[model samples]
Target: MLAEPARKFQSLAMAEPRSQQRLPKRLSRLLVVGFAVLIGLMSVLVLNSVLNLRAQEARVAGTVELRNRKIELATDLLMATYSRHNSLVYQTIVGDPFEQDDHFQQFIKWGYEVGKARNALRAMRLDGFETARLADQDALLARIVELHDRISDLARQGRAEQARQLIAVDLRPDNLKFIDSVDQLEHYERDRIQAELDAARSASRRAIFVAVGLGSAIVLLACAIAYLTYRQMGRYADTIDEQMRALEQHSAQLKHEATHDPLTGLANRSLFYHRLTEALTRAGQDQLKATVLYVDLDDFKPVNDRYGHAVGDSLLQVVAGRLLGSVRTTDTVARLGGDEFAVILLGVGEASRISRFEEAIRANLVRPFEIDGAELVPSCSCGHAVYPDDGVGMDTLLHAADERMYAAKRARKGGAAG
Candidate 1:
């Protein structure tokens, strides 16, 4: 009786469905494949949108160039017409026949330029309205040319007075009308170009919106797939959690490395500028004052030359620590590379406050540092500039501070030489 019961239990256990046991693995694989497909689709959508935007930008650029060229040609035509009229007037007034001939030749040259500009303007692409405007301008230009030719003929025939009268009466009004027409045409072309640019921008924005929507959808789908996979793989949660923690730590380390000096671990130049900008902005809004102190290690180079780079680097690290200890928590201390460092002091109201802060930094740095069992004394030259007083900008403040720092350095050198 006992043997039969045990055999039945074994047979039941062996008969359980193996496919049901493998279902989670197959589901996980499916979710992974789906996620990959969604990502690929998203990439394709983004690329297509970018390509379309570039095409639209190219079109806008070409339209702008063409519009500018059209305006230039129109202006050239107007000026040439005016120059021709002036030359004709000059030809009539000049007493010397040779000089009169020379003025006539100049008039002919200007007429050729007008014809060339008109032809070029006609060759450009034009809308129906622009075409009509251009036609009207051409008619006006033709009338001006006719009047100019008549004036030239009268001047050549020694009818100077009659030529001047015709110019003052007939030529001036027609020339002004022609110039007005050219101005109108230029304005029309500029309006068209602006419309084209606006349309292109609108299209680009639409494409971006579509791309963003698609990308969001893809991300949501991927998240759903990931959630399902996570549900099926609950047994590996601890491992995933550990990896996430490690990744977060690595990301933090990378950020710190990017904004900090690797050796001294102080804020680097980029972070310094970022902080300085924020300080300046706050100072402006709060009606408070700030100061920037540019610091240079006076004898750091000799120390590096006498000792090796390792000792030099150690000395720099010590200097960074001293600088940090010298400033307020709200203040920023940064290593502007090499033996140079910067400090931004906030809410510095009076000149004496800056003097006190400078004195404290100097006092901290003047202490001797023990390196390689040898006593080494480091001295620094510091220059300071007040916000709004020196100038109301980061570059200006830094420049002012740098100038002061160099002046201090020069004074020290001079005193030592003396």
Candidate 2:
């Protein structure tokens, strides 16, 4: 009986941590899902608000356009009225039958234009003030039209003096009143459009404020949830401490493996490009100079073929260390691939400085290396291109340097043959 009880207690104790571990994972998953959903909701809300603001802006623009059109039509009508009056006055003074007939035709044309403008204005939606103004303007225009007709008839009948007197007394005053009424209507429309635009802008601003406030609130809620989740995680920290440390170490190793060559411990192609891009950006912003050196190890394949990949790898590692030691800490040394390496020299502006640096690297690399109890000498062909001089972009610089490297290699082979 005592053994059975002890076994049961041990089994329960073994199951406890597993159950506890599973609970935190489920809770964390829930929190993460909830946060993602909230962020998505916030994005939707912001996008909707932006779309709504855009629509409102479009509506305001249309309203402004309509108001301007109405004002333009009203001005056109006023100008046409003045032109009609001038034609009538001219007809009365000329006394030629043909001139009178032309004036009468011109007067009729202007009258038609005024009627069209008035009809267009009437078709538009209008507020109370605009409607009253339109009514008054229409009445004045009708009286002016009647006076113009009477003047034209008198001129046609050869009563030129009577027509001139009617134009001076009755037609001019009523035409002036009509022009004033049109002016008032345009001013009223302008004021109303401005007011509406102002109101819309205020409303848009308020909506933006509301959206910002809501986003902030959501962020705060997310932070609170994160804090609670962190606290819950803390409860199991002791249980998972070793596992967390192991995971962190694994992550660091993975990062290193991703960015560095496994054999030589130099930066790989991906990390090389990343650092090169960063250096280019910095140089552009600061107006500084930099250079890229493409280095190819001469006669490296014979050693690899003779002594196997192990010696070859060790030689590459020694070469990498030498390259690292040759440059400033700010510079980058990367292995692009087998027997191929690249170096970025920062703040190197002059050709002489780059030449000297390249010579140093070559001298260091040519030194005999004692690997696996065998001595070996290695030589490298180097080609360099300056920033903003050879090329500003990565691809251009790389191409220039690569071309120079091939030329150097060809020259070296030709010299050896000679």
Candidate 3:
């Protein structure tokens, strides 16, 4: 009957194998290959994601440990500097001749030692708290140097009264600032580390959840695919399962490479764009808007031109990592080849989110990049384009955003902003 053929056509349409009339061996191979590819692709993605998350957690842990050690070292140096200053002041007041020369030399030695320590601490500028501390320490060092020079002159002229007057006013204020700066720096470091540790822990939990959820879903999909293929194979008397499995595996590898950057294994341009599109689409549906920022590194080409690509590559990796740390988990960051990067701000319905994002990026890039013990000074040119208003399509939005970025870059070149 006509109804029977229609039902048969529906069954064929839903069938996993090409046709239900094929041989069992052929059908089974087809089923296996198709399912295998689907399963494999999902499995690889889940695995790679888990691995990247673990690596990031390890990096954060290492950074926390490094900051703690540097803070302890800085504290020790600061205390020693404070002690030397106090000793010189006392020597001048008490007229202690026998110990004066030796103490003066020791004081100068401590100053040099402190300077070295400060230089070492400068490399810890990846974190915002540390950068602030670095600025404070710079100011503190200037004051300390002035104090040292003045004390030496006072000692030579035997001007105890003048020395005391200097210490009481100018020297005392800087000493207070130094002590306060140290304490503030330590507190800031501890708080920042704790917050980062907490974030890492939360990210770990979320990553596990995602891996488990996706893994389960993939397994279910594979099972569904296999079952459907097996049913068709029974009708056709052909092999199916093996082919599906092979297909699944190949798909998984391709997905891994697509989502991850080949060099750094961080998210690639495609993945970033995909996520941004998804966010923008969602925002559009909700009648809201978000922001897309194009970040281009300033003066990066000169380094590549001078230091060779090996060092230049290292610099890029370092900057990428720092930029990642600067943004929120919801933000999508991607390197768009060369020294250009982009970040997408999700759910940014208001202007404040854009402001905060800009501030964080500026703060992170404000400090120089220390590469191979040499400071690599660089800045960023950032331009933002809002969703919905900028453009409704991804390609259109990106083009607008890029134009804005080049505008910012030109502005930087013209010395309008740093």
Candidate 4:
């Protein structure tokens, strides 16, 4: 049973990599398919919109064509009535037999053209008002045609005066009424065409609005998908970058701890030598001299014995602060070992400058330290060696500074004995 369970666990562990790899591939395919569907949908909408626009164009065109044809028919009917009226009046006035006959023939041809125009108008679609106008015009034309034929007969019989009297009394007035009826029909058709065009335009605008709305929705959906995909792919890289930054900070902290002292948080023996070496190298390059101060606390062992290690450690930390304050930032101060500190002051070209700096260090140490309800005076013995004057190398400078420290201690001991 244990063996079977172990094998199943191993199989699950092995399956994870394959699943992880397939996940991205599946997501990619899904994204491609989604875009394809969106594109196809957009194309369909565009195709539908295009078809709608073409249909609207055709509708408007047909409406205008009908209006024009109807107006042409009305114009033809009016012109034909005018021609017949003038022909009847002319036949009654003219004395030449041939000329009167010619005018009569022209009148008949114009009347035939008028009938054809009416027939065409009736075959077409018309508003209720237009159909009523046509009926009124037809009644008027029938009366006018009867009066005209009587006038033509009177002219042919050479009773021209009677024909002219009939034309003045009846035909002229009826012709004007016929013209009015045709005008009404033309006006009605114009209004109808404008309404049809307006409807077509409204439909076109609605189709366009719908297409724009759908296109914006598709664009927003695509953007959302793209954002999700980008975030999904970048998550691991972001995590790795964060962890790398943390590791780099940890490595930096470890390196600092290795090179510095824990008690004072100052440079230790190893870093001090490194700094001293760099300072000397710079001094050698520029032909400038550097200074080294080896600091040792006086009676520190007695203080530790009297005050306990805790108080002694606090005092050491306080002394470290004072030493750091005494030097410029360009200078280096280090805790070499217990109660022992060293300083390297670069570009201190003249040995005379050391006295002023030494006075500053002594002033800070001279002040009493208040710790654990006790006022204590802490003093240190500082012995310094100058570059190229004592020796150019670090080891030579260190040895010379150390010897001078003991010599100074001995001189103080002798003076106190006196």
Q: TM-scores, in order shown?
A: 0.47, 0.45, 0.42, 0.46
What's the best-to-worst order under TM-score?
A: 1, 4, 2, 3
Superposed by TM-score, candidate 4 places the C-alpha of residue 388 at a distance from the truth, in angstroms, of: 0.2
Q: Which prediction has the highest lDDT against the true structure? A: 2
Candidate 3 is scored at a TM of: 0.42
Tens-digit lDDT track of model 3 for 1-418:
9999999998878885655556787878987886788777655655565466657556665766675666565665565655567566654644556667766776777777777767777755556766776788787778767876887679757887677667766776787687677768766766665676557656555555554454456456755544443343232211112322443464456456646666655677656755886888789888878888888988888888988788888887777887888888777888767788888887674667777887788788777767776688668888888888777666456667777878888877788655
Task: Report the C-alpha displacement of residue 119, candidate 4, in angstroms.
Answer: 99
Q: Which scores higher on TM-score, 2 or 3?
A: 2
Q: After best superposition, candidate 4 residue 285: deviation in angstroms?
A: 1.1
Candidate 1: what lDDT?
Answer: 0.77
TM-score (C-alpha, index-matched) for candidate 4: 0.46
Candidate 2 wrong stretches, greater than 4 Å: 1-23, 26-30, 157-161, 220-418
- The prediction achieving the highest TM-score against the true structure is 1
lDDT of 1 at 18: 68
Higher-ranked by lDDT: 1 or 3: 1
lDDT of 2 by residue, 66-149 (tens): 776776676666656655665676577565699788878887887788788888888987778878988898688678778878
- When 1 and 2 are scored with lDDT, the better candidate is 2
- Residues 1-418 of candidate 1: C-alpha lDDT, one tens digit per residue: 9999999998878766666678888998998998788867665665565566556556665776787678668656766765676577778766579989999998989889988988898788877877887788778877877888888889888998788778777877776677678778867866776677557656655664565455445568754543443333332333334433553465467457656889998998757876998999999999999999989998888888988888999999999999999989878999977899999998885878888888888899999978997688889998999998998866557767877998899899999999
Which segments of model 4 are wrong by more than 4 Å? Answer: 1-229
Q: How accurate is candidate 4 locally (lDDT)?
A: 0.76
Candidate 1 Cα deviation (angstroms), residue 227: 21
| CA lDDT for candidate 3 | 0.69
